[model samples]
Target: MKTTNAYLSKTVNELKPSGIRRFFDLASGMEGVISLGVGEPDFVTPWTVREAAILSLEQGYTSYTANAGLLELRQEIAAYMAREFQVAYQPDSEIIVTVGASQAIDIAFRSILDPGDEVIVVEPCFVSYSPLVSLAGGTPVHVQAETEQEFKISPKKLESAITSKTKAIMICSPNNPTGTMLNKEELQKIAEIAERYDLLVISDEIYAELVYDEVYTSMAAINGMKERTILISGFSKGFAMTGWRLGFVCAPKEITAAMLKVHQYGIMCAPIMAQYAGLEAMRNGQDEVEEMRKSYRRRRNYMVSSLNELGLSCHSPGGAFYVFPSIQTTGLTSDQFAEQLLMEEKVAVVPGSVFGESGEGYIRCSYATSIEQLQEAIKRIRRFLEKQTS
Candidate 1:
């Protein structure tokens, strides 16, 4: 009998289970659990996008294409970036279609990191970066963002995180769990720091379409930064095609080539059906994407206001679907707050500690849920907090 690899690779063994999963599992089994835990959009893939996938299957376009992905899809991706984000990429040489933004992150970390290289990751962040960096034989350096700054990282904070072993800085905007973004001036300052440190920037722009304030700024669009930045984005959030597992990364030709080598061997290619769907979404589904963005913006505004009214200090997120609110008023730890809320009020929100140690005093509530669900969740949360105070 195999002894379960008693000497399992340390990196694999060291991986901490995601905190988001535990709440989801509990909410899944419990009756009447209103979950604000997941970060995915609540919308279905638009009919036009779905129909494109079906048409591809009917046309027998099911076989795997080039490892870098279908040329048509890549061209469409390039066009979309140019049209929407003002970023440019040569479809043939500077982009690799991956399984999702998740896979793009994995491929990037593996490609750039040798053992012990350091990557600066801002918290509270999406949960995968730290573990993925470790899996790639790199150390993740976490820099905590303060609530007064709306959880946005400052250039001074970033400068302090860098050292001789630092290889890259990971940027997510509209950031996960926080829904915060780095403005143009902020991006320029970060670009200056990255230029000085000779750091690679792996920017996760998966939520680019969900911005409610001003236009989303692509780090790649900043001069002197484009060549050093690897942009990762996908149809999952913007087009509600999460299940399709389609994502891509755009980078300098040399970096893109290296990433494609890994994709060729490990991933082979993204799902053919999904690539077809993504192409269609980029081409003709603009109106649908806009509609979903409007809805999420409305929900975000409502949720943040409600949480603030309860005397919880919640910042208005400029983008993304989450609202990170301080739960300090209840004097409960993030985990304790989430647990009591779920058990007593039948409402589920993620504990901030799941993102990193800096997330301790807050909870991340996603507004991807429906308006009706959002209203009910706020009611439950209000009751739960009142009971705690009483």
Candidate 2:
């Protein structure tokens, strides 16, 4: 009989597993390992959100909701989007609650891409974007954004990457791996490119609530862009509800209909109880979000300053909870720095190279952990650096 590995689909066999998880697994049981890896918020889900879920269970709302999710939850999402970002999406036909922002991205790609269609992906970004596009039978074309550029893709570079095969552009503001956020002016440049090329734009704003220095802008709010943008966000980072697996997509009606077809066949709907929790979050979680954002901002300031003082150059991130610090000064490749740091001082960080080719000389350090943990980790890292130079 053929082996299971042999029987696996070629696409499945070819897909690269997440590099973040590999390091996380390595550091899992090591004593004194202070992980600056993993981008999850360390905070628990707010009591009110959890209480809402418990109440939902008590009310016996365990059944599957409509394939598009509960109408009420969708309405809350619509209202939340309007209030927070000033972007209006029709609850009835333009929104679909998803298992997570991850799934929303998957379905968005499936809805829009055909085999060989090219999706322009900016780096250093979240690890999943390229793989997800590939899984959807689309080719991912990468555009490297350097630290000098604040890691924002330049419009000239973006325009240069376009081709007859290019069908969409995927972006993450308050980007993962690096916490750099694109401003309104930056987004307007990208909007012009998308409009000129008639390309779909998938904007993942999962960390929208975590921005520290400036107001977050929704691509959908850009003139002439809403009709072509598939806006993906969720309760995970903002509401500390990662385990709830609740996210949503706001797109034009036709695109939403296509995404819903894939969602119905695959996920059916987001977990019903999670939907209830998300409803609570959308309606009542802004204070909790702001509190978490403030905590992250303080951590970001400390981490960035500490890294630079230690001879590792790092930029001050305006959003998200990560700082991408250049490790080139240490005369070590990113993987070597991460591996040695973990083995020596037990301070775990993700190598920037894992995010993309452009990330080779840097490392991603997440500030999502508590200030106390972050302080300890910083001390450990400093000790390790001292040993290296000594």
Candidate 3:
């Protein structure tokens, strides 16, 4: 009899599971673990959004929506994009609501990539980008954004990474793990490169609303970029609607049509209840979103200051709820620092190496939890570092 591994697709078997999951699994069921490992928002989905979903169910709207999602929700998404980012997308033909930003990312790759095509992925980025590109039968060429660069890729680095087989570039603003956001000027430089190279862009802006000191710019808003960019964002990060699993993609009609084929056959539509909740969020949840962003900003400030004070040497992140601090001074690798912290201090944080090689000496600590918890976690971390140095 053949083994299960033998029957697995080579690509699937070769794929490594997310390193974040490993730490989460270990921390689960452990007593008194203060976890900063996951990037999820600690805040509950707003009462209004939840109530909207409940109301939708009470009204007996439980059946499958249109494969492209409800017309109402799509229109709201279009309106929200235009209002927030100044990028125009027509409701009727240019949008597809998805299960989550993850699904949107997957379908975008499926829609545009052919086998052996290359996609330039910026790192340290979210873990899924490379694997998703590979699963789509494409090669993921990573362009490292070093810490000295504030973890933002320069246009020259991006241009140098392109080759004849390059088909797309994946960029996440207000980035994950590092919490670095690309400025409008930086995005314009990238836009120029994309146009010159004739490459598509998959811009992941899930954390756009969480920016603190800097304004978030949509790559689609840049000149000539709207036609060449596939914009992916979701309710998860911005609206704290992770469990609802609602997201959307905005692109040119041709690209949207192609992605719709994959989305239709695979997902049919985003959940009907979630779509209604999303519509409600677009309409009435902006204030709540801003409140959450402000809270994250406060926590981000506290965490960055505390981490640096603890001798961790963290850069001030412009957005998102995470602080990436170099642990090199502790004379430990990122994995070692995280593991030791979990073992000795019961504070779980993600090793930056899990994000990319450029993240080797750092660790990502999320400030999405409460201030009290942040204080306790930092105290424990400081104790652990002192012990290490001694």
lDDT of each: 0.92, 0.92, 0.92
lDDT of 1: 0.92
lDDT of 1 by residue, 314-389 (tens): 9999998999999988889999999989999999999999998888999999999899999999999989888987
The collision pairs in model 3 are none
The TM-score obtained by model 2 is 0.99
> For model 2, what is the alpha-carbon lDDT of residue 47?
98
Give the residue spans of candidate 1 off by over 4 A. none
Over 4 Å off in model 2, which ranges? Answer: none
User: In angstroms, how far off is 365's CA in candidate 3?
Assistant: 0.7
Q: Work out the TM-score per prediction.
A: 0.98, 0.99, 0.99
lDDT of 3: 0.92
Tens digit of per-residue lDDT, candidate 3, span 95-157? 999999999999999999999999999999899999999999999999999678788787778
